[model samples]
Target: MPDLPDISNIPYLPSPARDMNWRDLNRFKSSDRGSDFYKTCLDYSQVLWRQRLPARAILCLDRAWGADLTGDEPILESWPLPYQALVYILQNAPTGVFLGNPRIHFQHYADRLGEPRLEQRKWRSWACWALSCKARPDFQSDPDHDVEEPSLEKIAQKLDQYGHIEETKLWKSILQAID
Candidate 1:
């Protein structure tokens, strides 16, 4: 988190409005990699990501995709690719690069959220993959959905099925470290 400019020093406590700019966030000077403001924002994001339920998290994705993070187009747009990659890869759909924005098929995705398990993240990952898969040209969308709970079995099935093609490539990269 970078240093937050001293707004407290201002004479008037209230202002009608303040224009926010992202350039401030991008500004990096020398070793000023982690500013108070930047670290705060990342901490906020991490908290939000961690505490969020699967359903709510997906909904947040929807709102952000529909509109920039929280409103007027950001001066510096946020990249959702990392978020998307985390979601799809966890579900073993590493090739979901073709999955476009999930807005157009929101209902379809919201429906396929499967069941919840004690291990909550599993269903969220699967739901994320379903959304990603729906966008690919070949992976046809299916509305017949179920709320089946996710378990170790479910996770293994998804990995075995969807991860097959990428596993060899993934293992090759992993093996590189040994040599």
Candidate 2:
């Protein structure tokens, strides 16, 4: 492919989705390209979010989450950057930015999370593990997966309980909730 377009002036770009060639983004997929691809997508997503184009930002984030060389296990258990970005977006973006119910949105992504592993197990392990806490009683259930936990609601509640907390502290609380 041609050299990556100068993304420095993302604000001035017209037709960002096309300018970024989001549809063909997966063409860059390769084992060696995973981290860089994810980081680039994350950076663009953040820029789009700050540009008041949250819907587009979400598309970028979703693509980042689907980076071809990255496995869901690494995304769930090892990748801190994606987790941090996801937490930040979930905390800051308005629910209206999501096309449907936010829970359903998460659940949808969670459902699609590890197709390779999906057929091996009757129940989803990683994403469902992350989401099946009591706080989200609405999620799909797994008999072996129920854990008393801090759900996304718990994270949001903590954020609300302590108004204007430091960014690091906020990230800590969110991680704690998900962990």
Candidate 3:
């Protein structure tokens, strides 16, 4: 695992209300308060990504997405920023930097998370195609999948619908990278 990115420049922490050391973070990992644990990890992951430490960010995302041992309780369903960030990394990051197949990791988490709504499904397929630079598999195909030109406009519109102004700003920043 990589070192935690420097987030001192960031103005705010997301949840749990206090600074937590590794020990404190670990304590909640196994606790029944899974939502708290998940949010902390997800918030930290966003910080890491904003700091341009994607490798470390991925670790935090892994923890956040897997925080709940029992799959029945879905904590992140309402939070789409993390999923968008994951797709950004998947499409942009080099595969060699990570030990195992990043796509497999993504697929596993996506399966666990289950199929998203139509808008998210389009982004997922588009991201997958962007990563491979090849035709998407039939199973992942979408009517909006324009092979010659993939636009983030639709995804941005979807984010707008969610009404998370901060996340919308973050999504715009992420789009800047691709543009």
Candidate 4:
């Protein structure tokens, strides 16, 4: 196995997947030269690839979730790690998809998702915690898992409610909802 191509600009995988020892799923490590994940990314990508994709960019084939589960392509910019995991949980992956590891690069999601909103931080917490539970149940025992009380619908409704209230009065309602 001669040297493969570049990093493919694929997103990294967070360490939340069943304590599998988080790997830089996007980067090709020499140690991974014999791994199936590495080979599949290169093999399938080469077939569908057109004239030229950047040396650093490869077409992603591994999805965050299976096709039946993934929703729309995740709007992953600006969000924190837990939120990113939520999107992965909501949306099913295609034949292959790129999942980024937030611990390694927290800012990437925010950068890609775009500038944050004034209330973004408020609602995102509800989502992140719920998502973390679904994706990494290990965190259920963690103190920060604040989603024990509210149902997911209630959280979404709260987020929607925040979208309507004025910023001046928003804190009152948002705080109430979070509490």
How big is the positional error of residue 8 in model 1, measured in Å on the Cα after superposition? 34
Position 19, candidate 1: lDDT: 29
- Candidate 1: tens digits of C-alpha lDDT, residues 1-179: 55433212111111213322335334544234322333323332333333322233334343222221221223213332123422432233213123333432443444443432212233234434443443333544444544543443454455345432333233233223221
Candidate 2 lDDT tens digits, 1-179: 54433323232112334334454456564553465576567656756765555556656766554554423324323343344455444445543444223334444454455543232111222222343332334444444433443454554444344322242254444456753
lDDT, candidate 4, 19-38, per-residue tens: 22124344545344323443
Q: What is the lDDT for 19 in model 2?
A: 35
lDDT of 3 by residue, 1-179 (tens): 67754433222224333444445456663445467676777667656545556667666766654454233345544454354555555455443454234444444433344322434434443333333222112124333423333555654665566333444466565444543
Listed in order, each prediction's TM-score against the native is 0.26, 0.44, 0.39, 0.28
How close to the true structure is residue 64 of candidate 2, measured as C-alpha lDDT? 59
Sorted on TM-score, highest at the top, how do the candidates line up? 2, 3, 4, 1
Q: Top TM-score: which candidate number?
A: 2
Alpha-carbon error at 170 in model 1, in Å?
Answer: 21
Clash totals for all models, in order? 13, 0, 0, 20
Superposed model 1: Cα runs more than 4 Å off: 1-48, 68-131, 134-179
Of the pair 3 and 4, which is ahead by TM-score?
3
User: Who wins the lDDT comparison?
Assistant: 3
Cα lDDT, model 4, residue 45: 33
Stretches of candidate 4 off by over 4 Å are 1-119, 143-148, 164-179
Per-residue lDDT of 140 in model 3: 41
- Give the Cα-based TM-score of candidate 1 against the true structure: 0.26
